[model samples]
Target: MAAWLLAPQFTRSCHRQTPLTACKSNLKNIGTALEMYSTDWSGHYPPNLNLLTPNYLKTLPECLNAERVTYRIATGLNAPLNHGRFQDYYLVECTGTSHQDVNIPADYPKYTGIMGLIEQ
Candidate 1:
């Protein structure tokens, strides 16, 4: 009886989490594409995400659930760590979410690349 009563609540929560999970996975894949692009271009990230298509990325990944999400590139001022390169960059995503504080990392690039996906 208790299980039946609680099923609806669980279902509701799961629905919300599903989109968030998809968004996170998308962001992580974007980050991977960015990293690969930088490596091929001597540590300099592409001018925009579109540049990754058909090469580094097959297609631009969409925000799974959120609208008005922003992907930003933070360029490291220091010289490139690789051979005679010119730039270093970090990737971050600011996505729309249902909750205020459900931010999680994509766990890639050895840095905290995924930013908060706040309620819109």
Candidate 2:
């Protein structure tokens, strides 16, 4: 009886976390694609995320949250200042409010050339 009662709660918790997990995974994959694209392009990152498709990435990744928005590349004035040239440093972020339930690590830098998923 107790096991049955807890099953629903456990399932609900897992369901809530699915989107968050997917969002992180998507960001990581996109970051890898970005790195690969930069390497092939002689150290210059693409001007937009769409340029990564069918080459660096099989296809563009989308946010798994309720809004289901596409992840955006943070460049130009939006890119972090300490990361050197704007073309060398870019950040990818989900533009949805659904993933704010979880907190990111304090030490995690916004742009590391590998993965940068800002949840906001």
Candidate 3:
């Protein structure tokens, strides 16, 4: 007969591993949410950071990165150049890629993000 045992260290390792794995998971979700918003004809991008939640992340064990969202915005800072040129929109992940405090909007309850006009 073979017996299987998990060492105490393994337990600790699992605890440690969970967050990192979770963080990655959260990041992926953030990316996915942005993708969804991009396709949807919302007439704009996802709402501001203050409006995000798990509802956005279909992938369980949420992990979001809030700090990154603002900086990403700069990527699309320049938009709406011409007189009749419709401004471009952007999908951002401001939070820390974790579901820490993703605002839960009744409508798009998951992804908390910002939308801005930018140039192609």
Candidate 4:
């Protein structure tokens, strides 16, 4: 009886966290793809994420939110680069406020909903 009463709340919490988990996974995958692409392109990142498909990634990853927002790339001048080459890029989520229930990554700025590969 007690377990049954708490099941709904647990389910709802998990449901709410699903999108966030997917988003983080998507970001990590994309980051790996970007690094692979850069490794093949003389340390230069692609101008667009679509270039990663069929080679670095099987397909582009999308946000799993209610709006199903597509991820956006912020590269070149919009992102920090290494030695004037596009060695870094920022992948931003649409709407930017849909995933705030959890802690943002230390490398990622707060409330920006942006993830990226920054060359150290």
Candidate 5:
């Protein structure tokens, strides 16, 4: 009888977990695609995530439940022509969970600038 009573609670918790798991998977794939893109482009990272599509990635992965996942590359005209060699690159995913958002590569190099996302 107690197991039956707990079943519904368990199911609800599982349902809530699904999107979070999928979001993490998407981040991993995006990271792989970025690595490939860097290799092909003389170690330069894509200016935007869309640049990876149909070449490095078949199609960009959508955020599971949040608005969208964001890609931020810290490179510029005078920036060194290499990803991770001299600059900081990051991916941010807004979550459906109460945690708000999570940044891929949780660790970052010292003195990295905060790249803000414009509210849409």
Candidate 6:
């Protein structure tokens, strides 16, 4: 082995870390929103983020820092859990960030914004 510094760019960790950090931050915020939502209605998550917006959050927290925000509402989704009612729930998640190193990508951008089953 020659010298570690004398290599032709072994790897670039910065690129990977930046996005992952941002993704993690978004996840934490989303989780907090989910928790607050549960507290408001007793074990029930908001049907969607917008429901929390203007309430749990004054305005959307800007999940992704990309063009067009890359964040949008993926509508017509199946209820996240067994509410035992006629399609009475919904969900929204963050996107446009990556966490490949830990295999926990934020959601959306990579998954094409399809979190769960959705119907009109």
For each candidate, give its TM-score against the true structure.
0.53, 0.64, 0.33, 0.56, 0.50, 0.44
- TM accuracy, model 2: 0.64
The candidate that achieves the highest TM-score relative to the unseen native structure: 2
| Model 3 Cα lDDT, one tens digit per residue, 29-117 | 45555545445534444444222233443222322233233222211334222233334444333233233343322212222233221
Residues 1-120, model 4: lDDT tens digits: 011111112223435657656665566666666666666777667777677776776566556653453555565545532234443444433335555555543233211123343211
Pairs that clash in candidate 2: none
Q: What lDDT is obtained when candidate 2 is compared to the true structure?
A: 0.57
The C-alpha lDDT values of all candidates are 0.47, 0.57, 0.33, 0.50, 0.45, 0.41
- What is the RMSD, in Å, between candidate 1 and the native fold over all Cα? 12.8
For residue 93, give model 5's deviation from the true position in Å: 3.9
- Ranked candidates (TM-score, high to low): 2, 4, 1, 5, 6, 3
Clashes of each: 0, 0, 23, 0, 0, 0
Q: Tens digits of per-residue lDDT for model 6 on 35-113? A: 5666667556654556656566544545334422333332233433334433323344445343334455445322112
Checking candidate 1 for backbone clashes, the offending pairs are: none
Superposition TM-score, candidate 3 onto the true structure: 0.33
> Worst lDDT window (10 residues) for model 1?
1-10
Q: Worst ten-residue run, lDDT, model 2?
A: 1-10
User: Which whole-number lDDT from 0 to 100 does residue 21 have in model 5?
Assistant: 56
